[model samples]
Target chain A: MPPRPRRSYDQFCAAARALDAVGDRWTLLIVRELLLGPRRYTDLHADLPGVSTDVLASRLKDLEQSGLATRRRLPPPAAAYVYELTGRGRELTPVLRALAAWGAPELAERRPTDAVRAHWFALPLLDAVALEEGLVELSLEEGDFHVRRGSDGTVSYGDGPAPDEPDARMTLDAGTAVELGRGTLSVADGVRGGRIAVTGDGPLAKALRDG
Target chain B: MPPRPRRSYDQFCAAARALDAVGDRWTLLIVRELLLGPRRYTDLHADLPGVSTDVLASRLKDLEQSGLATRRRLPPPAAAYVYELTGRGRELTPVLRALAAWGAPELAERRPTDAVRAHWFALPLLDAVALEEGLVELSLEEGDFHVRRGSDGTVSYGDGPAPDEPDARMTLDAGTAVELGRGTLSVADGVRGGRIAVTGDGPLAKALRDG
Candidate 1:
């Protein structure tokens, strides 16, 4: 099939070019979903909530062409097509962090029209995990996800509790997590108020508790 | 007048919220234009080629409502409406940087449809300035601009040479600058190639020379 045309900015600037590739609607959020690891199409649609199936499929194809993501059939027993980010695609961790930091204040209140998901809260709280390398399982009122902050600087998270024992584990409500993410509440303040719970004897746990 | 509705993802996640504000077409490019300091509407139009007037106006209005930009008339002597980024809006610098860093490699070739502006190159090159807190005036074959890398980690640059004496001055062609921005070439490599000419004995200049 002929590729879908890209509505590029047609600018020589790097930022403009980046926007040309990922500036389309739902693209970065799709990146957010895959950052958690490989996900089947249905899982992505479930987490994203509002994107149209056609748009999702189009974006996945675009991401694949842009070399940001890849799609392949899973081997054997649990076979299904899945999409995952390439190393270059995973480099958006800092961009995600910056966006989360910039937008945390805007999240003062959830509108009646807003959809909620627990792992949706993961990107904002990823930086707070503070582990140089290791898995940190997060338990939230809505759900749980284990974020693996790599020493190489890519941050990835997967659904459910940590598959293996985690380096650190944190439990907090969405409300408190947002507050902490926004700096409306500090780590020490969250700990003092019992809004945040930290476990595990690892440095990240100690850092979270002692902060 | 009633505000135009925001086409949000309707997701409560902060990154999603941010995307709701910025993910629109030309919104961030507008931010990019304003980051060089206040710009007259016509000037912005000139610099941001390929943006339709209607789209520009809409993006500007959206930016204003989202608190990323503001519009105001200049004082009597040089009166003209100008748009500038708010402090909160300027916080996207890191996001811009990360995007630039990630997208730099894609700039391998400028397409036939691509437009070029000397200042458009400033944002990606801002970080290579290196000093903790200093101004580095860059003179390129296409034009000149000065970048101020603040101690607080904010990188802002403007058109023309530095208003005051810069800590360092470097003259290079845009091709070499692109290489440096893309990470394919280092500042040290550029200097060694004599593609870059650095002046002034300030720490930044000395560091660039030493590097």
Candidate 2:
């Protein structure tokens, strides 16, 4: 990428550079809420009730200044303002979805079922992305699990038993499988160590290894 | 967005939901750091020196579970992990960039220049989308300000005297112009109120109205 004019930076690391803008806890969550649609200030406040009005105002100002959101006045005498993600802001949906998917299982494990329902803003991003063709089914005798595609390039998590005719199959405990999905451990290594098992096409098996 | 799979409500939004399988906070920051390139865990620790080893280990687990990053075991049996973003994780570059840009000005205002530099991950997204083409020069008595569209679609902000061959001219104070950029007031309103003066191209004048 070419250098941004006027903005000066001595650091060479890109991630550090990115953190300089969004490292705050509220900002990414705000981006996540905007992915759903344009919202009024009160609407955003309701969605993220934990955020103070002042902080929301500041974040909105920052977002507009950075050109991620455009704030427009609504029609009539309401004097209300609507904040919509610019095209640039909308592009962040995928990152938020992937992050949500990665976090869901742990979230499920931590909270009781009754409490999770209140979180309207916490939906995963994959739900918004178009799912790709081909399905993979896997079953374990004992475990709670979710699946994410290495090849489909859409990161998501699902509940319950895998479909009957998936393109491939792998069986492992929930935690270990999630670890594999995260790319922390290689499938080949896991298989060699007896942490995971395969029961499908050899090519698909190899593909998992490659992933 | 599709409904979340069967589970009760509380499970949905707790810290568990927010926390990735890799862990929370630090992992995302670590991934944001690696999105630029690979780095040793110690180097990552340096970027976020406040994080303890136990916390770092936990965060690495969560990041690995999310597939946003990968840890390669390097040579000589050193048992060290060098982390880098995966193809999926790299997609977050723009999001990180936007956050950096949003935080930069405030970080500068609050902290000394020598404090950790503000990262600018959002610049690419801004350059890719928000910028509009064409030059609109606003000439003030103190000095002229130029807003021009770059080939890449980024809006350039510069300070200097007016150019001789200007397509249009508008006289306004710098502070008011910045306020307009914030969407707090309208340029046409300002002009009608005699706070600003416009000359030259009619279409350019209209563009400023829209802006």
Candidate 3:
């Protein structure tokens, strides 16, 4: 795709420059979606429920032009174009994490009109858990999702069931999950208090069970 | 003023909530201005060079409605309305710093079209210098500015000269200042190399001189 004209803050400040790139309404949200892993346009649209199709397409193009993401076709049986983050793009994960931590207080209440997805809580929940490496499938009242903690320290999560058999499976209500994300509740305490049920034969399951 | 209706992403994610509040164009830059301290409308307008007057007014109104900033009139002799950041708004400093650090490399080469401000480098330079507490007046070729390092761990910087006599006053060219902000050059090295001239009888000056 040809690059669109880039709008700039035009100031020499680094923060301003960063904001120039990602401060648009749906830009970082799109980055968050890409951080989960590569996804087809349909998948991204489905997961980010509120974004308009036009805005999503424009943001993906912007991400591509900015070198944060790229489109590639899958080989063979699953031949489909998907958007994925670049190394420079993945560096934005920390920036997203920082924003997530800072904004956590705002999630104390879910307004009557609020829309939600089980995977929208994925990143914070990933932060809440402590594990060196494992795949954990989470079953929340809202839906089911899976998270992977790589030995390389990189983490990623997606909606629905795990792409493969997960090392651990946890069942918890959305309230307990939100509490965990807010740091008001701990995974150990949740497990100990029986608010969270763990099932699996992996080390992660053993740790949760022992807690 | 009555609150304006807010537009939201409708998601339950903290980062998304934050974006709903500050993700608009020029919102964070306005936050950047308030971080310097209270500013009259004219002052904000002058510092933020590119924002349209209509947009600025709308953003200020949005910021007020969001509890990020508030406006009040100065007492007696200085009876003027000024906008300042609230504690909630001030908490965004670390977020800005993270973005600044992450975006520093984007600042390596100044585009001929880029706008320059001496005080714009203040936060990054403040990060560059290691200090417990002191007021440092910095004279850059672009302009003069001052930075305050408070004992309480709060720091602030403003355009133009120090409000009062400063503990240390250092003079250097804009290039050296940019280098300092980028962390490519240290204060000690700049001092020892005679690129930076430090003057004053205070401890900060003495440290800069002895180095």
For each candidate, what is the lDDT? 0.85, 0.51, 0.83
Give fnat for candidate 2.
Answer: 0.22
Give the least accurate 10-residue stretch of model 3 chain B, judged by summed lDDT: B123-132
Question: Given candidate 3, what's the lDDT at residue A184?
Answer: 89
Residue-wise C-alpha lDDT for candidate 1, range A1-211, written one tens digit per residue: 6986889999989899989889999999999888888999999999998899999999999999999999999998988999999988888777787888888988888799998888878777777765458788889978998888678866777878999999888888888889878877776578888888888897777877787
Superior candidate under TM-score, 1 versus 2: 1
The top-ranked prediction according to lDDT is: 1
**Predictions' DockQ, in order:** 0.79, 0.11, 0.63
lDDT of 1 at B48: 89
The pairs that clash in candidate 1 are none
Instruction: Give Cα distance to truth, residue A140, candidate 2, Å.
Output: 28
Per-candidate iRMSD: 1.0, 6.5, 1.3
Which residue segments of model 1 deviate by more than 4 Å? A151-154, B151-153
lDDT of each residue in A1-211, candidate 3, tens digit only:
5566889989988788888778788889888988878899999998788889999998888888878899999998999999999988887877787777768788988988788888877877777664648888999888998888898988888878889998888899878887887788878789889899888897887876675
> How far is B9's C-alpha from truth in model 2 (Å)?
14
TM-score for candidate 3:
0.86
Tens-digit per-residue lDDT, B1-211, candidate 2? 5432422223243222443232234555665556536678887776664578888876775566567678897787676768877776665544444344333333322223322422222232223212245555555444544555657854433334334454456677644443443334576677777777766665555555444
